[model samples]
Target: MKGFGLKVTETGAKSYIYQYRIGGRGSPTRRYTIGQHGSPWTPTTARTEAERLARLVGQGFDVVAQRQENERKSVSLAMPAYVEAFITNYLTTQWKDEADGAATLRKHVVPVLKSKSFPSLTRSDITAVIDKIPAGQMATRRKVFAILRKMIRWGIGRGDMPQQDNPLVGFEAPPAPASRDRTLTDGELVLAWNAADDLGYPFGPMVRLLIALGQRREETSAMEWNELDAASGVWTIPAAKSKNGKAHIVPLNDVALAVIDGLAGCADSAKSANSANSARRWPKRGLLFSTTGKTPASGYSKAKARLDKLMVDAEAKRAKETGDSAELIDAWRLHDLRRTMATGLQRLGVRFEVTEAVLNHVGGSKAGVAGVYQRHDWKEEKRDALQAWGRFLEQLAAGEPEQSNVVHLAARG
Candidate 1:
């Protein structure tokens, strides 16, 4: 009776009430309307309501404040709603530079969790969705999980969600994947280089350019004629196109220049003759490697598969010629060529700073205060290193053994 009461009006309407002192004795005790005392709110039901409020008071929550907060976020501030708000307002705007990060959330996280109300997103539901993703693509799963966790934290901090307990608190993420550092040996490089040439046109030229320039695959793939300075032998990767968000000046060696020349000729021949043969490699005049100028170069997976077979055939042919069993090279990715070039420079004793400069790495020794102070672009060093490597590649392609010990300055003098 102390915590509960009944009210009756002249019209015979009756209701239940629960009252509580805010600041103890002599302070104003507030009465909360529990329910109308009728079918649903009999004395027994009204008593239960009083008991619930009493427990809440014991737990130190101002039930009135919580109700108001819940009411505020009722429909428009639901879980999915807050998630979208986070993406549009926070992820997209404040973190504008990380477009890929926002895209991943919008693409992967939004669709799966959009309909799920924020309060309804339990650990089990999160785990269930994660479990369905195949183990072969754990890396993607891990990213999605991480993004979702961040979203939950953001909601909690902003008071969009109940300001307690992270839904993903104890759930473990899939192991972070190992970074790929695969590199092709000199033999593999020569074999693959020849194999790419035999493959012909687009994929061939793209592969050669990747190895030739040691640039990223997409950068090589998205090349435009305008980016090339034929006379100076510089293939400029514009800031927008480069991964590091810096314009990269790749000093092209004779072989790289020759490959570019061959590709341009191939594209010209295809266009003049009105053939679709080069259409896949040269979508338009400006594009150097794309199948369609509107998009970056594609068919990488399929093209790589074809290149593998060609390499194996090259191995077989060599075996037949030498009267010895020739073993095909080990498996590798297009990125391995980039690594191989970096490794080759180091093995040849080229300065690591120059190597980093050629790769356009924004971090490591090339970055931070050290990078700021070391304003030297190492342009001349990079050119020398690339030219030396190009000569080695030419020798290998022509069946002449590599002269790795040759000193550039000594030879010049």
Candidate 2:
């Protein structure tokens, strides 16, 4: 054959040759010299040699082809490929509504694990990443463990990851979450409420609402006018927004309503400034307390820092008159307000079940089997409890400390 060649000239010489494309059909063809015939290569040997080359070509294992396949396999097997797939496919469909879950992955999990292989990922690898998160951030540590549990379970479910080989498979995995019981005292509540006023407008009202409503930070911060019924004094938190995955009707008292009204005044004032031209431009719908009405209130960290400073200044002023330093107010988080509300409700003699209902909790009498049977909305009782609690809060916040639930003993006796 000319290609598997035998070339005989005046000085007879014979040789073998091969020609093929590196990448199939449209690729430029390449030719390679095999061996000469008549010296080491006879016609039979040349034919045998050509047969071996044909086998290699058919099996797709020529040097160039093998190299390309190896590169493809390397890329397919890479960790980044799996991470991208998991976030794109799993997180979007399954965890789409979970903002905090998504944030945890982006902030803590994804950064450390984006390029890490599932098979090679070890316990130490997970632990090291967690340890890098600043200590005392137990909540964040717990969240990381939660994300790992979900991601590892997701991988194992998908069948590529073997359960026995799973790095996250363990008896004692996530550390027990730290319990919080810090309730601001009535006097401290008043001090904090006043300080919140100095913080001003959205943050001030936000902090007050945190104390007044006992709703979660995310729910209150993202409050929309649509969620509130001004006429009925009801704020309907839809199942989509609620933590318990249940629709909750929270009855706002006068104090809570007034805070919202103040926010409305600000918005109306902004509209009135350019009502003719900017009527459409002003966001009249979305958030009750946002600079741009399309979004929810943010700047919590900075706003809280300012509120803390105001508390410190107030404490110093009190100490200046008293000559004894009134205990400097302890550093408190905004969440403490919710706890204070729960505790305060009990002090005001709000019934236990009603209190839990106000908090929209599923625990206590509402948990497990009881939750299945107890379908009652407790709407009237919840409304009463919130109204009663709201009234008690107004008394304290209005600087009437002399009238707290104290009884004169000796005179009555």
By TM-score, who's the top model here?
A: 2
Candidate 2 yields a Cα-based lDDT of 0.71
RMSD of every candidate to native, in Å, equals 11.1, 10.5
Error of 2 at 280 (Å): 19
Model 1, span 56-76: residue lDDT tens = 977777766677776776655
Report the number of the highest-lDDT candidate.
1
Give per-residue CA lDDT, model 2, range 1-413, as digits (tens).
42366555577765666666656878776555566766678778877776777677767656445657856755644556765566777776676234455556667865776666665677887887688787777777877787777877887888766888877767355566578888898878877877877888789888978887899888888777778765566789878778887888998765576566566653322221112443222223688667776556666778999998988888788889889767757777898898899998898888888888999988998999998998888888888887777667766655554546533110111
RMSD in Å for model 2: 10.5
lDDT of every predicted structure (CA atoms): 0.73, 0.71
The C-alpha stretches of model 1 lying farther than 4 A from their native spots are 1-173, 179-181, 266-285, 402-413
